[model samples]
Target: MGLLDNLKAKLNPAKDKVSGLAQQHGDKIQHGLDKAAKVVDEKTKGKYSDKIQTGTGKAKGAMDRLAHKDGTDAGGATDTPPAPPPPSSPPPAS
Candidate 1:
Protein backbone atom coordinates (compact mmCIF):
# COMPACT_ATOMS: atom_id res chain seq x y z
CA MET A 1 0.00 0.00 0.00
CA GLY A 2 1.10 3.58 -0.54
CA LEU A 3 2.11 5.71 2.43
CA LEU A 4 -1.28 7.39 2.64
CA ASP A 5 -3.10 4.10 2.24
CA ASN A 6 -0.97 2.45 4.93
CA LEU A 7 -1.64 5.31 7.30
CA LYS A 8 -5.35 5.06 6.64
CA ALA A 9 -5.29 1.30 7.25
CA LYS A 10 -3.49 1.75 10.56
CA LEU A 11 -5.95 4.41 11.70
CA ASN A 12 -9.06 2.58 10.57
CA PRO A 13 -9.15 0.24 13.57
CA ALA A 14 -8.79 3.10 15.98
CA LYS A 15 -11.57 4.94 14.21
CA ASP A 16 -13.88 1.92 14.34
CA LYS A 17 -13.19 1.36 18.02
CA VAL A 18 -13.94 4.97 18.78
CA SER A 19 -17.12 4.77 16.72
CA GLY A 20 -18.31 1.72 18.64
CA LEU A 21 -17.58 3.27 22.01
CA ALA A 22 -19.35 6.45 20.98
CA GLN A 23 -22.44 4.51 20.00
CA GLN A 24 -22.47 2.72 23.34
CA HIS A 25 -21.75 5.63 25.68
CA GLY A 26 -22.54 8.77 23.76
CA ASP A 27 -25.20 10.12 26.09
CA LYS A 28 -23.17 9.61 29.24
CA ILE A 29 -20.18 11.16 27.51
CA GLN A 30 -22.12 14.21 26.45
CA HIS A 31 -23.52 14.65 29.95
CA GLY A 32 -20.04 14.52 31.38
CA LEU A 33 -18.86 17.07 28.85
CA ASP A 34 -21.64 19.43 29.87
CA LYS A 35 -20.79 19.02 33.55
CA ALA A 36 -17.12 19.66 32.93
CA ALA A 37 -17.90 22.79 30.98
CA LYS A 38 -19.99 24.08 33.85
CA VAL A 39 -17.16 23.49 36.31
CA VAL A 40 -14.68 25.24 34.02
CA ASP A 41 -16.98 28.21 33.61
CA GLU A 42 -17.32 28.51 37.35
CA LYS A 43 -13.58 28.39 37.79
CA THR A 44 -13.06 31.13 35.20
CA LYS A 45 -15.82 33.22 36.81
CA GLY A 46 -17.76 33.33 33.54
CA LYS A 47 -14.94 34.95 31.60
CA TYR A 48 -15.02 32.23 28.93
CA SER A 49 -18.70 31.51 29.30
CA ASP A 50 -19.52 32.08 25.65
CA LYS A 51 -16.73 29.85 24.36
CA ILE A 52 -17.52 27.20 26.90
CA GLN A 53 -21.14 27.17 25.88
CA THR A 54 -20.18 26.81 22.22
CA GLY A 55 -17.87 23.94 22.96
CA THR A 56 -20.47 22.23 25.08
CA GLY A 57 -23.05 22.55 22.29
CA LYS A 58 -20.65 21.12 19.74
CA ALA A 59 -19.79 18.25 22.00
CA LYS A 60 -23.47 17.47 22.37
CA GLY A 61 -23.97 17.54 18.63
CA ALA A 62 -21.08 15.18 18.04
CA MET A 63 -22.50 12.90 20.69
CA ASP A 64 -25.84 12.88 18.93
CA ARG A 65 -24.19 11.82 15.66
CA LEU A 66 -22.22 9.05 17.31
CA ALA A 67 -25.09 7.68 19.34
CA HIS A 68 -27.66 7.97 16.59
CA LYS A 69 -25.99 6.09 13.79
CA ASP A 70 -29.35 5.14 12.32
CA GLY A 71 -30.36 8.80 12.05
CA THR A 72 -32.97 8.39 14.80
CA ASP A 73 -32.81 9.55 18.39
CA ALA A 74 -31.67 6.81 20.74
CA GLY A 75 -32.70 8.40 24.01
CA GLY A 76 -29.84 10.86 23.84
CA ALA A 77 -31.17 14.40 23.55
CA THR A 78 -34.83 14.38 24.52
CA ASP A 79 -34.65 11.67 27.17
CA THR A 80 -32.25 12.51 29.92
CA PRO A 81 -32.15 9.70 32.44
CA PRO A 82 -34.20 10.56 35.49
CA ALA A 83 -32.37 11.37 38.69
CA PRO A 84 -32.62 9.08 41.67
CA PRO A 85 -35.54 9.65 44.01
CA PRO A 86 -34.96 11.43 47.29
CA PRO A 87 -34.64 9.34 50.42
CA SER A 88 -37.75 8.86 52.51
CA SER A 89 -37.91 10.35 55.97
CA PRO A 90 -38.71 8.26 59.05
CA PRO A 91 -42.28 8.51 60.31
CA PRO A 92 -42.95 9.99 63.74
CA ALA A 93 -44.19 7.65 66.45
CA SER A 94 -47.94 7.83 67.20
Candidate 2:
Protein backbone atom coordinates (compact mmCIF):
# COMPACT_ATOMS: atom_id res chain seq x y z
CA MET A 1 0.00 0.00 0.00
CA GLY A 2 1.03 3.56 -0.50
CA LEU A 3 2.27 5.61 2.45
CA LEU A 4 -0.95 7.59 2.66
CA ASP A 5 -3.06 4.46 2.60
CA ASN A 6 -0.94 2.83 5.27
CA LEU A 7 -1.27 5.86 7.50
CA LYS A 8 -4.99 5.92 6.91
CA ALA A 9 -5.26 2.25 7.86
CA LYS A 10 -3.61 2.91 11.19
CA LEU A 11 -5.80 5.95 11.85
CA ASN A 12 -9.07 4.26 10.93
CA PRO A 13 -9.53 2.80 14.39
CA ALA A 14 -8.86 6.14 16.00
CA LYS A 15 -11.33 7.86 13.71
CA ASP A 16 -13.95 5.33 14.58
CA LYS A 17 -13.28 5.80 18.26
CA VAL A 18 -13.61 9.57 17.94
CA SER A 19 -16.84 9.19 16.01
CA GLY A 20 -18.29 6.93 18.67
CA LEU A 21 -17.32 9.28 21.43
CA ALA A 22 -18.73 12.22 19.52
CA GLN A 23 -22.05 10.49 19.07
CA GLN A 24 -22.28 9.62 22.73
CA HIS A 25 -21.38 13.07 23.94
CA GLY A 26 -22.49 15.32 21.13
CA ASP A 27 -24.55 17.67 23.25
CA LYS A 28 -22.05 17.76 26.05
CA ILE A 29 -19.28 18.43 23.61
CA GLN A 30 -21.10 21.32 22.04
CA HIS A 31 -21.82 22.76 25.45
CA GLY A 32 -18.17 22.61 26.35
CA LEU A 33 -17.30 24.36 23.13
CA ASP A 34 -19.60 27.22 23.93
CA LYS A 35 -18.23 27.53 27.43
CA ALA A 36 -14.65 27.48 26.23
CA ALA A 37 -15.29 30.11 23.57
CA LYS A 38 -16.81 32.43 26.15
CA VAL A 39 -13.86 32.01 28.43
CA VAL A 40 -11.38 32.65 25.61
CA ASP A 41 -13.20 35.73 24.46
CA GLU A 42 -13.27 37.07 27.97
CA LYS A 43 -9.59 36.43 28.55
CA THR A 44 -8.56 38.05 25.30
CA LYS A 45 -10.60 41.11 26.15
CA GLY A 46 -12.34 40.66 22.82
CA LYS A 47 -9.38 41.85 20.77
CA TYR A 48 -9.82 38.98 18.31
CA SER A 49 -13.47 38.54 18.94
CA ASP A 50 -14.51 37.83 15.37
CA LYS A 51 -11.78 35.32 14.71
CA ILE A 52 -12.34 33.60 17.99
CA GLN A 53 -16.06 33.33 17.32
CA THR A 54 -15.45 31.96 13.85
CA GLY A 55 -13.01 29.34 15.11
CA THR A 56 -15.34 28.21 17.82
CA GLY A 57 -18.08 27.86 15.26
CA LYS A 58 -15.88 25.81 12.96
CA ALA A 59 -14.67 23.63 15.78
CA LYS A 60 -18.22 22.99 16.87
CA GLY A 61 -19.12 22.13 13.28
CA ALA A 62 -16.27 19.64 13.02
CA MET A 63 -17.41 18.02 16.21
CA ASP A 64 -20.89 17.87 14.79
CA ARG A 65 -19.55 16.03 11.76
CA LEU A 66 -17.78 13.58 14.01
CA ALA A 67 -21.03 13.04 15.90
CA HIS A 68 -23.23 12.82 12.83
CA LYS A 69 -21.99 11.37 9.57
CA ASP A 70 -25.23 12.12 7.79
CA GLY A 71 -23.42 14.59 5.56
CA THR A 72 -25.33 17.48 6.95
CA ASP A 73 -23.73 20.79 6.18
CA ALA A 74 -21.19 22.05 8.67
CA GLY A 75 -21.82 25.52 7.31
CA GLY A 76 -19.39 27.14 4.93
CA ALA A 77 -15.64 27.44 5.29
CA THR A 78 -15.95 31.14 4.57
CA ASP A 79 -16.50 31.80 8.24
CA THR A 80 -13.09 30.47 9.09
CA PRO A 81 -10.53 33.03 10.21
CA PRO A 82 -6.93 32.99 11.23
CA ALA A 83 -6.31 32.17 14.87
CA PRO A 84 -3.32 32.31 17.14
CA PRO A 85 -2.03 29.30 18.93
CA PRO A 86 -3.33 28.79 22.44
CA PRO A 87 -1.25 29.85 25.38
CA SER A 88 0.87 26.97 26.59
CA SER A 89 2.47 25.98 29.83
CA PRO A 90 5.95 24.52 29.82
CA PRO A 91 6.09 20.80 29.25
CA PRO A 92 6.97 18.57 32.14
CA ALA A 93 10.52 17.23 32.17
CA SER A 94 10.93 13.59 31.41
Highest lDDT: give the candidate number: 2
Candidate 1 collision pairs: none
Residue lDDT tens for model 2, 1-94: 9999999999989998999999998878877877787777777766666777678767876786666644554463333333333343323344
User: TM-score winner among the candidates?
Assistant: 2
Clashing pairs in 2: none
Root-mean-square deviation of Cα positions for candidate 2 versus the true structure, in angstroms:
9.9
Q: Relative to the true structure, how large is the alpha-carbon lDDT of every model? A: 0.65, 0.69
Q: Give the least accurate 10-residue stretch of model 2, judged by summed lDDT.
A: 82-91
| True lDDT of residue 47, candidate 2 | 68
TM-score of 1: 0.63
Which whole-number lDDT from 0 to 100 does residue 14 have in model 1?
A: 83
Q: What's model 2's TM-score?
A: 0.69
